[model samples]
Each structure stands twice: as structure tokens, then as C-alpha cells.
Target: MTNSENLLEIRDLKVYFEVKGGILKRTVGHVKAVDGVNLSIKRGEILGLVGESGCGKTTVGRALLRLIPATEGTVYFNNQNIFKLKPSELKPLRSQMQLVFQDPYSSLDPRSRVGDIVGEGLRVHGVSNRGERHQRVLEALRMVGLQEHHMRRFPHEFSGGQRQRIGIARALVLNPSFIVCDEPVSALDVSIQSQVLNLLKDLQQTLDLTLLFIAHDMSVVEHLCNRVAVMYLGKIVEVADREELFRNPQHPYTQALMSAIPIADPKIKRQRIILQGDPPSPLNPPPGCRFHTRCQEVIDICSQVIPEQIDLGNQHFCACHRRQPVQEAATS
Candidate 1:
């Protein structure tokens, strides 16, 4: 059973990409890619990070695993500060934290056999000998619904869904406690997407894995995640339990995102929120709330001061200056 306690705790994590420019070739400014993101994921829980393109959803996931180093703040994985670990100390931890890349076609090595590709992690981590690694690779492939005979083939030989299965097998071979699935199903056909999603869900339950599933699809998040975070620009504007946020979204940006999701019932129509203007450049994000430029319910205070995340009853959180506590809003 999941401990219901924090498996990963991230506080004020900031990841900035430096942009060198100007006539003198100086570092003029930085792209505030992931600014002060605070979140915690419990053991075996899947936290869905959803947002539009360039919203830093992928950066947050990558930073947590130190694929890209954070500019500031702390990342605690199972109570150990991940940033503090030396190169040698981190080698073993690499096996525990794995990543499933978005593009299956390009992720695997063309020269390597499917079996060798999956077993590479086992070999790197010194988990077993060559014979044992081969066995583990076949087992991982089977877990993802692929036959052992297919292990001899190359990544090019499989369909998109099968390639994704290979990617999943690669991650699972390490027996990771945590996996960052960055838009895992985005490249596949709609039909294949569901198959991959179901496979992930089944694997999560069976392996007791913790996941940070990043995607732009709200429906995908709704189906797979227990809690959802909405990101805009470079900041997380709202986060809450999946059901509660969908039922009562306090942030205007989040509401806009929810409106875009197609409802199954034809009678239950939702007004699509179309925002004017493109998202601000990460090199220079807008002052105060990054979402203020496009928010429908903007106020003067939103432009002057950055809103702190407020708990709006039942664990729902929103970072909007105009937001009232859920109880207060209900009473009024």
C-alpha cells in the first residue's frame, strides 16, 4: 500500500535557462522556465502536470529528476535532498528515478536490439550479470504485453504502440520507484493512446510506482491522475484533487483550460474560453501573475502583486488574487 506520506517534496523549485545576448555577448537575462513551483507527490500516486506548450510542464519534470539542474530551491526524494547527492552517490539513485520520453521512435537506439535496449539499465546499475539482464529484459517486455520473441527485433520493426511499450519496458527494467512520463501518449494515434494509458495504469498498480505524468490533454489527466496541476507560462496557477478542481475551479486560467475539454453528453455544453494574444516569452515573463495577461477575471491587484497559493477548502489550491476561499465564496 502507498504510505500516503510524501514520496517527493519540492519547495520553491526554480529552473532558469540562461540566454546570452547583446552586442557584447553578455548574459542579458534568463528564461524563468520553472519559477517557484511547490508540490508534493505521495508514494504510488500519479500527479498530472497539464498546461499549454511552453508552460514549463516538461521543465518541472526534468528538473525534479535533475535531468536539468534547478536554478534554485530544493527537491527531496524520499527525504534525501536530491541536489546534494554527489555524482557517485547519484549513480545508484538513477536506477530508482527513471524517465519515459515522449517520442518513442527516436528514443531507442537503432543499432541496439530491443532486448539489449531494455536491459541497458540493468547492466549500467550492475543489477545482474549478462544472462540475468537478458532474463529481466524479457520479463519487462512481457509486463508491457510484448512477446519475448520480439526482443531480437529493432525499434523500427514495431508499431508506434509497440515502440512505446519498449520505452515503458526500458524504464520498468530498472525497477524504478518513480517515473516521469513526459507526454507518453501524445505521439500515438487516439486508439493507441488509450492502450498505452491503460498499460501505464496497470503497471503503476502492479509495481507500486509513483508517477509524474505530464501532458496537455485534460481528459488524459482526468482519467489517470489523482491530483492535477495547471501550469501557465512558467508557473503553476492551480492544483487540486482531480474531481474537486474539475467541479469547482478557482483560477480563471484553470477554468479556461477545463472549458476546452469536450463533454461526453451533448446536452451539457461548455462555453469555450478563447484567450487573446500569445503566451509571454519566458525570457521576460509578465510582472506579478504570469497568467494575468490572459485571465478573464483580472484585477488591478493581480498586476501589482504576485498571488500566493491559498487553500480553498477540501485541499483545493489557487494562486489568484481575485479568488475567495471556497467556503466564503459559497456563503456569499
Candidate 2:
């Protein structure tokens, strides 16, 4: 796709944390949290980043917002390289790109009133006038199906769903173009999860917002996202349109993940592909294809060489030796 079509682009994104050892606290190794991830989010579409826990899905989201420093890579927001910008230059852009955190309980300050929490961004970005900030906060809360009075109370007074709505309001109050929703509904009850998801869907449509929705649930991704990217051990294994990926998952990892999604109909039995072994530690990940150890479809090349992301028509891409063309695989 053209650069003009995308609101955000991440190229070769890698975030590694230093692992200290010994009394001197010297660097022993690195935890490759997000390694060589490349993806793009369109102007008004939700792209789901799905993987098991510790797969670096959250790191990618934080890196996009520059919440944590990246070891290497470039992130272009509106064609501007965010990593190249100075602190002063980046500060203003923060309002345009916001994050809705996973846990509402911890994300919100207990001591602060809802109004202050939601309007904190406005205050930081120079909405100095209290009346204006209050009005904006009220408008945001209303959009999330919350009343004006709810803002006067503290976070402790609200239910789990309301607190999440408040968190969403905090992100929305800034009138952001792009939002990194870091599993906004994961902590809530199943019923509450649907409510929060619906609210997000409605808000995205109403506000024309682009979202990088990070989640482990395939069913939720299928419901909310326009496109999906499957991440495995800090690398994206596959990317495709929502319908296409759900209908025909190419990578073995992607197929295994898709198999775990519970089908509602009891009559229609689906075979479950249970992945063997645990995920390799990020501190010392296995060579070549990270999923090769657990993947049932074993090939000699998979253990020896990294697979290139191969295009499979209709905007679908898979990074798997098995998915490569027979002639291309033979040549390699």
C-alpha cells in the first residue's frame, strides 16, 4: 500500500532490555521484546496485533507512542519520523497519539477525581482554562456513555466497566487521530468486555480514529479489527485482512491460534491444534524460526534459516517455510 494511505508505519522495530548480572551489574544479555516488527495502520482502520503473553505485543504499542525507548527502528507518524524528533517536537505529537491502558484500576489515580484524570492531558498540553477543560472532559465522558456527574467522583466509586470508559475518555479527550488500545477490555467481565468493545467500535466510527488494538483473543480481534497481524516471539508471523486471515490462516502458529477460538455451535466440531512446548524465553530466543520447536509441520530449513514474509495475494502475508512457493523453497 501507498504511504499516503497509512497513518502510522513501523519499520524494523526492535526494543531490547538489558539483562544485568553479577555484583558489578554488568550487562549479561538482552531481552528481545520486540524484534524486527514491521507493520502499518491505515488512517481509519483497526489493526489487531495478536499473540500469546510475553510475545511483545504490548512493547510494540508502547514503542509506537515512544513510552519506552526503542533499541533500533523507525516509526513514522503522518510521514514524520518520530524517533528523529527532539523531545520538544515530540511533546506536541503526544496529544495526537494516545494510549488506552489495559488495567483501568491501576491506570487511573485513586486520589484524583475523574474530571482531573480525564482532563490531565488537556492541562499538560496547555488547556489552562479550567472551564474549557471541564467542558471537554464532560463531552468525552458523555461520548463514552458516562454522565457529567460521574466526573466529580473518584475512580474508586465507579464499576470496572465505568473505569475503563473513563480510561477511554482520557484518551479521547485529546482528540487523538491514532490510539494504541492495549487490550482495553481484557480485565473486565465477559458482559462488560462486550460493552467496552462496542463503545470502542462506536467511538472509532464516530471519531474516525485509527487503532492498533493489542489483544490475545482471536474472537475479539475478528469482531473489532479490519486487518490482523499475528506476532510470535517478537516477530510478526502473518498479516492479512480480517476475513481472509480468519478464513485461511497460512502460518502454523496462526493456524494453531485460530484453532483455539471457541466455536459457539456445539454441533459444528472444530479440531484443535494444541501447540507443543512453551514459548522460548525472550532473553535467549531460539535461532531461525522461533516457532519451529513447537510447530507440528517440521521442515529442515525451518531450523536453519529465517523465513521471509511471503505475499499470498489479496494483501495476505506469511513468514513460514511451508507457505513459500515450492520452487522458491527449493532454491533457498
Candidate 3:
């Protein structure tokens, strides 16, 4: 897609964290948290990234907002190179880009009142004048279905769901064009998750906001994302529209993930493709296709060389050496 059509474009993004090992104070290796991830977010679209834990879904979201420095590659926000911006030049852009982190309980300041926590962004961005910031905070709270009276209470006073709502409110108070929801609903009860998801959908449409919704739950991604990308061992295995992915998953990893989603119908039983062994550690990622070791239909090519993302009609992309055109629709 063209630059004007995309809200956020990330090309070959990589984030590595330095790690020390052995007793000699020697820098052993780096954790390849996000290794060569490439994706784009269209204006006002929810792009979901899904994978197992430690798969770098959260790290990609954090790196997009510069919460962590990227070791290599480019992050373009509205076609502007965000990494090139100096700290001062990036300050204004910060207000336009926000994050609603997971674990709302620890994310909020326990000592501060909810109002102050939510309004902190407004204050930092020089929306001085306490009255105006307070007004914005209340409005933001109301937007997230919280009352103004609740603002005076501490974070510990609210339930897990309410805490997440406050976190959403904090992100909203800045009136950002884009928001990274880093597994925002993962910590809440299943019943409460629907409430938060519906609220996010409502708010997205109301505000015309773009979002990068990261989660390990395929069910949650199917419910909220316009498109979904499956990740495995710090790499994107496949990316396609929601219906396309559900109906015609390309990669083996994506298929495995889709099969695990519980089927509601009693008569329609699904066959789960259980992968063998644990995922390889990012500190020393396996060469070539990371999923090859566990993939049931692995070919010789999968082990020796990395797969190139290929388009299989409809712009669906997959990076599996054994990926082939399906004669039938996805069973599950």
C-alpha cells in the first residue's frame, strides 16, 4: 500500500536486549526480542499479532512506540521516521501515539488517585492548568464507562476490569491517533473481556483511532482484528485478513493456533495439531525456519533456509517453506 494509505509502517524492525552471562562480566549475547518483523497498520484499523508466550508480540508493540529502542530497522509513523526524531522533537509525537499496557494493576500508580494517573499524560504534555486537564480526565473516564466520582479512588479500589478501563482512559486522554493495546484484556476475567473489547470497538469507531492489538488469544484476535498476523519464535509466520486467515490459514503455526480455539458445536469436533518440544530461545534462535523442528510436515528445505514471504492470492502472505495452496477450506 502507499505511504498515504498507511498509518504506521514498520520495515525490518528488530529489537535486541543486551544480556550478560558467565561470571566474567562478559557480555554473552543479546536477546532477539523482535527479530526482523515487518507489518503496517492502515488508518483506523485493528491489526492483531498473535503467538505463544515469549514470541515477541509485546516487544513489537513496545518497540513501535519507542518504549524500547530498536536495535535495527525503521519505524515510520505517518511516513515520518520516528527513530530519527530527537527526544525534544519526539515529545509532541508522543501525545499522538499512546499505549494501553497489560497488567493494569501494576501499570497504574498505587499511591496516586485514578484521576491523577489518567491525567498524567495531559500534564506532562504541558496541558497545564489543572482545571482543563481534570476536565479531560473526567471526559476520558466517562468515555471508558467510568464515573467522575470513581476518579478520586485509588487503583487498588477497582477490580481488574476497571483498572484496564482506567488504563484505556489514560491512553485516550491524549487524543492519540494510534494506540498499542499490549494484551490489554488478557488479565481480565473472560466475561469482563467481552465488555472491554466491545468498549474498545465502540471507542475506535467513535474516535477514528488506529490500533495495534497484541494478544496470544486467537479467539480474542478473531473478535477484534481487521487482519491477523501469526508470530512464532520472533518472526511473522503468516498475515492475512481475519476471514481469510480463519477460512484459509497458510502457515503450519497459524493452522495449529487456529485449531486450538475451542469449537462451540458439540457435533463438530476439531483435531488439535500439537507441536512437539518447546520453542527455541531467542537468545540463541534456531537457524532457518524456527518452527521446522516442531512442524509435522517439515521438508528438508525448511531446516536449511529461511522461508520468504510469498503472496498466495488476495494479498495473503506466509513465510513457511512447506506452505502450499489448500484444496479445501480450514477444517476448524
Candidate 4:
């Protein structure tokens, strides 16, 4: 509701990559990977970021952690802007924020043992004693449903699920207050995916951690996130509580996405919405409404004017010409 309630607040965030051409390596143009996004993660809540591939969801997560340099905008963690801090100054604060990478196979070092992999963070932050680090590592492993015996083995020795557990263990070892879960379940088997998601939920409650869970699957978001944000072409088209967004998607792009989610029952038939063409390249996005090209409900002004983020009741926000803003809620 206010800045005090938010653990992380993002304002007009933008990340653009320069397109180079010729042997001279001149800047031909820029790919607006993350054009302009406004989001906030409340303390101890899982905010799901869902979108199609190449929609800049991963880019947004990476930019928040400063893994990649941002083109513009600010990220405030605990009311402090992170990009302003120097590397040395930022290093200490980094321990409070961590990332669980998508691919557990490549994320872990194959050459290193699990103990060393998980304990490395503690060592970096100066745990100082071997005994304490070992205990902490074991506790973290146990928390993620892994045993101390497995700690002695290398990444190559473990299964996909086990490796993922190791990765979670590594993040948990830091005792971070905030984490970016970058599709942590996408690489696992369907059955194993639920296990990992449940493990994360358990860890979140146990640790009282704030999470930014990014994924392509709507069902997964519905299961784990408190609120879901739908991204399309570097912009958040809709954001609402999991039930509100899924049940009443306002944006055309979001509706199209929701329609595609397969239903388990054949007894009930649902209308399917098929978009006309692929999303336009980020380097040359549409002048006004990015979705106008593919939107079935497009109006005359849809292609000429940028739609404002109209706040529907109950903190539900959507950008579309057909949706009217609720005067009671804040509009941006």
C-alpha cells in the first residue's frame, strides 16, 4: 500500500541493448528489451512474473540483481536505490538478495562438491570457522530435503531434482531476505516441478523471504504466487491477484494467453483466441499500442494512442482501450 510495505519497488525500468552493424561496429539501433515497467514486491510475498519467451521477463529479473547493467530507471530495495551504490558498497547488501538460476545443471559447478558449492557464499561473507560453515551447510541442505551425505558428491553425481535442490540450498545458505526465482521449475519434470514449487513455498514461509517468481506457466503461477504480472513486449499489460487475473483478464494479449492454457476436462468447452501474428521485434515496436497488430478487439485509437495503465478495483491494473479505469484506485 505504501513504500514501507514494499521490499522492492521498480519505477519506469528500462533495459536496452545496442544493435551493432558493419566492421566499424556502429550502433545501428537499440533493442528495447525492457522498455518501461513499474512493479513492486511486498515483503514476504511471491510476485509471479509470467510472459511468453523473449518478453523481457528474465531481463527484468537480471537487471534488478545488477547481473546486467540497466539502460535506465532505478531499483529500490528497502527504500534504497541499488544502482547508485559502488561495487564494494553493493557487495554487502547483495547477501540479502539472491538468484536461483533456471538451469540447475549448468548453474552448479560440476567440478566442485556440494558442500563447497553451498558454503561458498558463507565463506565470501566471512563465516570464519569451518565447523559453523559445515553446520550451516548441512542445515540448509536439510531444509531443501537433501542429506548431509550427498554434500560430498559433485554435481555430475546427482539427478536433475537433486541438483535443483542443491541450487536452492546454495541460495538458502545465504539467508537472503529476497530472491529472484528465474524459472527454477521449468527445467524439471512435471511431477518434480510441483515438488520444487512446494519446496520453494515451504522455504519462503520458513525464511520469511520475498520472492520474484518468473515463469511461462500460468498454472505454476496460480499455485505459488500471491499476485501475477503479465508481460508482453517489454511491458506489463496486466497485474492482479492470481484468481483475479486468470478469471478476468482485461488486456487482449493477456486474454489470448489465458485462452491457450489447456483445460483438463473435455466436458466443458471454452472459447479459444488465436492471435494473428508473432510479436513485433523490440528494435522496432509499434508507435503506440504494441498489441494493436494482433489484438482482436482493436479500436481506431488503439494504434494511435498509448493506453494508460487503468486501475480496476482491488489493485488490479491493466492497459487497454476497452477497459475503463476505476476512480477509487490509483492510476499510473
Candidate 5:
């Protein structure tokens, strides 16, 4: 179990990419990939970051690790402002923070064996003893259910599931306190997806890892995360505990998303929400509520002004013009 206090605090983080055009290649506009997102993660709990493709979920995860620079805002890891730290100061903190990328196949090198691939971080961080690195690599691989002999083989030699395990092993090798799991199982088969998620949960429990699980799949998030935050057009639409969010989603975008999760039993009747049209382009998103264009229950105020995040006690919050707390809305 983890403490209730936040281990990672992000405030008003923005990552806008300048778009250049014309023969002059002059900066025309900006892609607001991440726009003023705020979040906090406890020391050992898994926080799910969910949103549609191109909604900047991955960007948020990348920014938290400083893999991508933030145009504005601050990231505080355990009360230390990471962005203000110099390169030399940042180096030691790297082992404490790591990223398990989305594509396992592309992330690993074809030229390197499993041992070298997993130990690359140690090598870069000056863990120069080959003997020590080898032992650490073996231990990490074993933690993810890969055998010692498997370390001699290449990444291409393993199945999709095995390769993901290797990727998890790569992150674990550093013994990092925080990991950004950027849709680690999205490319795998359904059967393999659960296995990888389970492995991650088990490892988190064993090692007390704090994870930011980024994915578009709500079912996976529901299964693994203690709390879930729904993102829409770079802003967090809603955030609450997993059970509360699923049972009483407060935002229109979140309600539509939760409704789309495929259920196993056909006998159970659940309302299905089909959103029309694509999400607004990040290059030029809609004003006010970014989701106002696609929301089914759109109000006049939604199109005119941005809604403030309203608190409903118990840390549950949402940005919506019409939605009230679950109890009040239900009783009304």
C-alpha cells in the first residue's frame, strides 16, 4: 500500500509543438498536444490515463518523464523540481524514473541480445561492472518470467508477449520508483494483453512501483488502475476512483467512453453511446469546452465558455456545464 500524499505533482503542464509551413518554413501555428493538464500520483498506486487517440494521453506521460520538453508549467517529483535540474543533476534521477514504450518491437535494438538490451541503462548510468550488470539483468528478466538462458537470444526470437515481458524487464532493471507505461499491451493479442497487465500488477505489488498506465482501452484501465483520469483534447475531463468513475462517470466524454466498453454477456442491457464525427483537430481545436462539438448533452454555455473543474468531495472532480454530483443529479 502507498501513502495518500502525492509522489508526483504536475501543474498546468503544456507542450505545444510549433507547426511550420510554406517554403520559408516559418512557424504558422502550434499543435497543442498537451494543454494545461494537472495531475498527481501517489507513491505506489496505479493511475490510469485514458483518452481517445490524438487526445494527448501519451504526451502527458512523456512530459512527466521529461522525454518531451514542456512549453510551460512544472513537474515536481517528491518535492524536487525536475525541469529546473541541470543535465548532470538529472542523470542520477533517471534510474528512479523510466518509460516502458508503446511499441516493444521498435523500441529494442535488433543488434543486441536480451542481456545487453536490458542492461543498457545501467551501462549508460555508469554501472560499469559487467558482472554486476549481468546479474541485475538476469534478476529483472526472472521477475518478468523470462528464464536466464533466454537472455542470450535476440528480441526477434520471442513472441509478442515475451517481447513485452522483455520491455517490462528493461524498465524493472533500473528498479525505478515511477514508470510510465505507454499503452504497453495495446499491440498484443487479447490473451497476451491480460498476461502483460497481470505481470505489471504483480511486479508493482512486489516492488512498490508507482505507474502511470496510459491506454485508450477502458476495460484494461478498469481492471488495473486504482483511479482513472479521462482526457479530452489535452484537458482532463474527469477524475475519480476506478469504481466510482465506472459507476457514475460525470463528464459527457467519460460517459460515452464508459458506455463503449464491450461487455462479455449479451443478456445484460447497457446503453451504448456512439459519438459522431472525429475529435476536433489539435491544430485548431474548438474553443471553450474542447469536447463541446461532440458531446451529446451539449448546452449553450458549453460552446461559449470553458467550465471550471467542480469538486464533488472525495477528490472526484469534473469540468462540465450541466453535470452535478452523482447524488444530487440522481435525486433530482
Candidate 6:
């Protein structure tokens, strides 16, 4: 699709943190949290980012909003390079992009009232008119199935699910076009997860909001996202339509991840692919394919050459030597 079709486009995004050690605490190495990730979110679709823990899913989300600095590459939001924007210039754009943090209990201020918590963005963005801001806050709360009475209460008073609703309301109050939902439902109970997921679905449809839903749960991605991107060791291994990825996972890592999903039907059993060895550390990620250490179908070239992203048609993409071996000349 054209650039006009996408609200956010990430090109070669990389986020690295300095790893300091010893008495002097000088930069010894870098933890490559996000390495050369390329992704796009359409105007009104939920794009799920799934991976194992410590794979840098959260780092990508944070980098998009400039919560954390990127070491390299560009994040184009409405065709504007956000990484190049100055602090003052980025302030207004903050309203257009918001984040729903993973833990609701910790995200909200215990000392503040619910109304104040949800309306904090408005206050920051220069909504000085108390009456107007109050109305907007109430409307936002109502949108998330919260009543006005709940607004006066503190964060400690609400249950985990209600606190999450407050967090969602906080994002909505800003009227953001794009939101990075960082495992919004993972902290809640299974029953509450469904409720919050349904709420997010309804809000996305009603507001035409685009989202980057970060999670490790395959079932949740299937339920809420339009497309799925499988990440490993700070790099995206495969990306495809949600249904397409689930039905035919291209990368070995993705296939292994899919195999772990619980099959509801006890009568039908599916083969499980257990990957050997643990994921390599980001500080010194294995050369070439990061999954080479644990990949079941490893080739000699896999250890020496990093795979290029291959377009398998119909917007499906995979980066694996097994899928299509990289030409030696291309790597040079």
C-alpha cells in the first residue's frame, strides 16, 4: 500500500541502551533492544506485536512515542519524522499519539483522583478551561463504561479491571489517532481480559483508532488484531494477516510459537515444536539469524548469513534462510 494508506511507518528502527560496568561505569557494551525493525500501521487497524519476554516488544512501543530514544532510523507519523522533531515541536503531536501502559495499578497516581488521572493529559496539553476539560473527561470515562461517580474516586478504590478502564479513558481523553497498548489486559484476570479486549475492539471501531497491541498471547492476538508481527531478539521474524499467520506461519520461530497455543478441542491434538536452547542475550546477539541458536531447521549458511525479509506475496513477509537462502553477493 501507499504511504498515504498508513498512519505510522517505522523504518530501520533501533533502540539500544548503554551497558556500563566496573568502578568507572563507562559504556562497555550496548543492549540492542530494538534492531532494524520495519513496520506500518494502517489508519484503523490493530497490529499485534507478539514475542517471548525480553524480545524488545515494549521497547518498540516506547520508542514510537519517544518515551525512549532510538539509536537509529525514522518513525514517520503522518509522514513527519518524529525522531527529528524538537521537544517543543513534539509537544502538540503527543496528543495525537498516546500510550496505555501495561500495569494499570502502577500507571495511575495513588494520590490523585480518577478524574484528575484521566484528565492529566488535557492539563498538560493546555486545556486550562476547567469546565470544558471536566466535560471531556466525563465523556471519555463514559466511553470506557465508567460512570461519573467513579471519577471522583481514587485509583486505589477501583479494581484492576476498572483501573485499566481508567487508563484507556486517559488515552481516549486526548483524542489520539494512534495508541500503543502495551499488554493492556495481561495484568487482569481471564474474565476481565475479555471485557477489556471487547472494550478496546468497540472503541477502535467507534473511533477509527489505529493501535499497536503488544502481547505474548497468540489467542489474544487472534481475537483483537488484524495483523500479527512475530518478534525475536529485537527483530521481526514474520509479519502477515492475523488469519494468514495463524493458519500458515512461515518462520520456524513463529511456527514454534503458534504450536504452543492451546487447542480447545481435546479430541484433536496438534504436534508441538519445542525449540532447543535459550534465546541468545541481546548484549551479544548471535550473528546472522538470531534464532539460529534454537531453530529446528538450521542450515550451514544460517549461522554465517543474516536472512533478508522475503515477500511471500499478499503482504506476508518472512526473514529466514530456510524460506529463501540469501545470495552471497547480496550480503556483501
CA RMSD for every model?
Answer: 2.8, 2.6, 3.7, 1.9, 3.1, 3.1
User: What is the number of residue pairs that collide in model 6?
Assistant: 0
Against the true structure, candidate 1 reaches a TM-score of 0.95
Q: lDDT of candidate 2 vs native?
A: 0.94
For model 3, the local distance difference test gives 0.90
Model 6 worst lDDT window (10 residues): 323-332
As for candidate 5, its clashing pairs are none
Q: Which digits, one per residue and each the tens of the lDDT, describe model 3 over residues 1-332?
A: 33788999999999888898888978889988888999989998999999989999999998888888999989889889999999998999999999998998889999999999999999899999989998999999999999989989999999999999999999999999999999999999989999999999999999999999999889889999999989998899999999999998989888887887777788987788887788889899888898888888888888889898877768699998776644446433
- lDDT tens readout by residue for model 5, 1-332: 22348899988999999999999999999999999998899889999999999999999998878888999999889888888989899989989999998888998898999999999999998999999999999999999999999989999999999999999999999889999999999999999998999999999999999999999999999999999999998999999999899888889899898888888888989888999998999999898999999999998999989888887756799999996655666445
TM-score of 6: 0.96
Superposed model 1: Cα runs more than 4 Å off:
1-4, 263-265, 326-332
Q: What does candidate 2 score on TM?
A: 0.97
**TM-score of every model?**
0.95, 0.97, 0.95, 0.96, 0.96, 0.96
Tens digits of per-residue lDDT, candidate 1, 159-192, equal 9999999999999998999999999999999999
Query: Model 3 clash pairs?
Result: none
What digit string (tens of lDDT, one per residue) describes model 6 on residues 9-45? 9999999999999999999999999999999999899
lDDT (0 to 1) per candidate: 0.91, 0.94, 0.90, 0.92, 0.91, 0.94
Clashing residue pairs in candidate 6 are none
Weakest 10 consecutive residues of candidate 3 by summed lDDT: 323-332
* TM-score order of candidates, top first: 2, 4, 6, 5, 3, 1
Worst 10 residues of 4 by lDDT: 323-332
Please state the error at residue 114 of candidate 4 in Å. Answer: 0.8
Model 1: lDDT of residue 275: 79
Determine which window of 10 residues in candidate 1 has minimal summed lDDT.
323-332
Q: Which pairs of residues have clashing backbones in candidate 4?
A: none
